[model samples]
Target: MSAGRVAVAALFVVALVLFAAVEIASRREGSRVPSLGDVCGVVMRYRVGPLPVGRIAMFGFWWWLGWHFLAR
Candidate 1:
């Protein structure tokens, strides 16, 4: 594998470990850590017509980023 691919894989592994660590630490602390969904729900509590502007912006960014990387 190329160095760049190896680096990406390494970072992916690190992210997985970091996510697991966060879950374990939060459970041990006996504190309720709000998840991404919870935060988004709180942020978009306002009615922005039929669809929320935040959701449109977030999905647009995700779509653009995925296309930019995968279309290469």
Candidate 2:
């Protein structure tokens, strides 16, 4: 694979592992929520193979929130 694809795959695997680990840790610890960056990073990583669904969903969610609320 190309360097970019390898990097993306590595990132995706890391993100997925981190996301799962963090989520499990949070549940065990009780009452702490993961940060926005963590979630978005996971989504971006997951989309690496799929080509843009994750990215689009992540950005679209932000856009809707900004448009409906923050932009006001």
Report backbone clashes per prediction: 0, 0
Residues 1-72, model 2: lDDT tens digits: 899989988998999899787777756555477665676788877655658778888789889979976776
**Model 2 poorest 10 in a row by lDDT:** 28-37
Task: Give the clashing pairs for model 1.
Answer: none
TM-scores across all candidates? 0.53, 0.42
Instruction: List model 1 lDDT by residue over 1-72, tens digit each.
Output: 899999998998999898877666556555687655566677666458876777777778889989977989
| Predictions in order: lDDT | 0.75, 0.78
lDDT of 1: 0.75
Work out how many backbone clashes candidate 2 has.
0
- Candidate 2: C-alpha lDDT: 0.78
